[model samples]
Target: MKKSILLMTITTITLTGFISGCSRDYTPTAEATGEDIFKGACMECHDAIEGKENIFYELTADNKNIEFFSKKISGGSLLMPKFPNITADKLKAVSQYALDHSADK
Candidate 1:
């Protein structure tokens, strides 16, 4: 009886956690700001300004600009995943914002 009760408790807790995780609102709104887009699209793989992997990429004026950022965000690289659904306006906003906050900027 105790074993059955324990199993039931574990199952309930696991299902609850899974359901809660799937209910998150990950999609950004139409009026979302640059910061919002960055958080939704980039934050999963990168920390605020740095990559989460072995190679740390600190943004700078030379390497991080509107064009570079926009291309990287839309098309992605070997390690990055492309964000095809992101609108042009959203991409521009995030790219400009990233350039403005680069280390040398």
Candidate 2:
């Protein structure tokens, strides 16, 4: 009886250790910023404009608001690529970044 009790206690401790080890701590991450999205997606094309000849400079200036920026980004123009899969929040971020950058130019 004593031997059986000892075995059961050891088993229980082993199982408890295994269970605790298996459990993972997951920390939530912060959301990506506008500049991050822009560099990931827009920088491929927009990073450089020959002779600083950016056609969208004026356009972004005109449509600096989030609503207009989101619409333009989602719908796309003749030159701009359509980003249909981009989330609305991400679009807003990139739009805000674009406007801010344009302000510097």
lDDT of each residue in 1-104, candidate 2, tens digit only: 99999999999887666444321221112477877766665655565445564333445345656777777667766455556655667777778877765633
RMSD after Cα superposition, model 1? 9.4
List model 1 lDDT by residue over 9-77, tens digit each: 999887666444321334557998888787676665555544433222466557766888888877766
Off by over 4 Å in 1: 1-27, 49-57
TM for every model, in the order presented, reads 0.59, 0.53
Clashing pairs in 2: none
Weakest 10 consecutive residues of candidate 1 by summed lDDT: 48-57
Name every residue pair that clashes in candidate 1: none
Instruction: Provide the lDDT at 68 for model 2.
Output: 73
